[model samples]
Target chain A: MPKGKDTALMSWKEVPFGCYILESGNSVKFKTGDWRSFRPVLDKEKCIKCGQCYIMCPDMSYNQDEEGYYIVDLTYCKGCGICASVCPKGAITMVVEEV
Target chain B: MLKELAKFKGFSAKNLPKEEPFAPGHRACQGCGEVLALRLALKALGMNVIAVSATGCMEIISSPFPYTSWRVPWIHIAFENAAAVASGVEAALKVLKRKGRFPKNRRVDVVVFAGDGGTGDIGLQALSGALERGHDFVYICLDNEAYMNTGVQRSGCTPYGAMTTTSPPGKKSFGQMTWKKNVPAIAAAHGIPYVATATPAFFLDLMNKVKKAALVNGPAYVHVYAPCPTGWGSKGEDSIRLAKLAVETRIFPLYEVIEGKYYITRKITKPKPVEEYLKLQRRFRHLTEEHIREIQQRVDAEYERLLRLAECL
Candidate 1:
């Protein structure tokens, strides 16, 4: 088992006694994760990256990695479709992730 | 103490209940003015009334299947039929009141809430029908200036040269070309018992108008200028301040049309320039110098017209 999962399981015995707690346990679930995630899939074929998508996205979900290529962070993406629509090159498509 | 003396002399503050009729957990965009309007309207009306909301942001957010943000008995009808629905409810309540079928012969005032698109555009016919038919109900148009729920599309209430999804400000175009439809004027033409324009920024004025409209025997129309933060690219909390500026600028005059007479309530001693109101929202960002002059001219013309009406009465 993973270290976090093992910690969670071991903490159950201490929960009833109210004496022990695991600091490394994955007990906290972020409330915002339930909201829909929109990942921008770049179509390199239509590759005139004008950076409009990067500028328009309110969440700052997209950034160029060290390789100088745009990468999207899906964790905080609200799927507002603003980035895709603002892309002048139409190089980005918003994809919904399965729950 | 002076504080104790002040309290003794009818200066004690009453605590308003924190229980919101429009509860949290419903999905409305951050800083939605329509929700604020509904909440305030409900607060004024209290718990004894039933609300009929049109198919807009308020309805979509408040009523979803078995879940509801509304603590009061609320109904969401078709987009254009909120007034008509409220009329029916009022009629039914009237009949029940006559028959003494209601609990303790209580009277339920029917209140209809709708957006600008629902009122000035799609729902105008139904609203006219209700008004002409002389229903005992209050109809409120929470005018946020556009079809915000449908992704900030331009509606008839959208001002001239204001950008939206439908009226994008492009190199060749100056956003929306048409002026906002004068909905209160049209409602006034119906010669209803009461018709008024209000804003949430003036809470007491809004509450008093609502109370007067509620007590009126026949149909009453209240058009509230609700600011949309997300749609207008403005700060959410600036809604009330913008509403106040709208009134101060004379873009939305706080006035009442009562029984064929016009009364200008809360008139500004020195009206501010329309630019003060227009400059705050990004919707009017495309407005040129010529456009601003035209808007100022129109605002002055409308203010003069209203003043003439007040003088006539």
Candidate 2:
């Protein structure tokens, strides 16, 4: 996840044989929240919990709570405003740098 | 083994599948509909499959060094040989099962994900050969309308009057003078078992078609109209809306061809004008009124032709 690390510093022995990543879905270790210029804020009162935002988020940032309300994890949300635009009830709104 | 949806049922809003085969944290562009389509696709097919990716946006974003977004087994092949690699994978699986080296009952689905440039242009020959040879694999073409991975350039699947780096609209010429090639028709011509056109806007329909493709025995090709907000010069939030308009305006008709029989998936009874679809993307912003009319007529005619084919069934 370190952006400044030099690739040349790594030894050839550290590379995976044939470059096959043994850990599946290992990309989750890298957080991409900093890339977003905007962040989505949910209005809990207006949410119908239709799961629309949860399914539609390209970043897979939304997770449903036990109460059936959807919460966006800023760790991966790209602030694309898709969730706000797709929300039928206008529960989610995009704001600048809320995170 | 591939679990076929015995009944032709679609997932409702409340009961959608919760599993995510494509993980987050990879660097796909914000609001990238292509990756969203890929996510929905792998979700529909489940994790019991092997995915072969061509050198495209999906390949680059999903796998970077020691990290991979794919939870299932994936292979990255060349720009023009995803189908070939998939064919080899399917053949190897068959041979291994027959030799008792693997579980005889295990039937892992082989699926290929290729971009527009890879599918309709570079990989067309390889795809044709694999389909003709009757390989048990599903080839999904994620068409973003141009060579988006290598920067926006004209592709065989790029629509007429659309601006790209290579097909720039100027005083001398209009963007993409030629009409979009009918790749799905070409696939249908191969006389394969399954062929479909879907968009991520209709998530249920897209997922159901993918499931059905895996259910079918022979070669299956699903052409997905994925919106590239970054390349198309459109608002990221408009990706889904644009795809929906593409269907409603009759610009990209949704349908399926099963063993030479055609069936229109989402019929648009009250269609909107083609301009409604074109005006959203800056790629088609340079079109004059006459050009708009030309595109409208062509889209309507193409839809009518498809309707006639569906009617024959």
Off by over 4 Å in 1: A1-99, B1-19
lDDT against true structure, model 2: 0.91
Stretches of candidate 2 above 4 Å error? A1-13, B1-8
lDDT of 1 by residue, B1-313 (tens): 1121123221111322233455444555544556656766666677778889899888776654334566677777889889889989988887886788877456567899999999999999999999999998999999999998889999999998899999998888999999999999999999898999988666656766776777777899999988888899876545666887898988899999988889999777698988888888888887888999999999989999999999998
What is the iRMS for every candidate structure?
13.2, 0.8
Q: What share of the true interface contacts does each candidate keep?
A: 0.00, 0.78
Q: For residues B111-205, what per-residue lDDT tens digits would candidate 2 score against the true structure?
A: 99999999999999999999999999999999999999999999999999999999998999889999999999999999998999999988888
Error of 2 at B123 (Å): 0.4
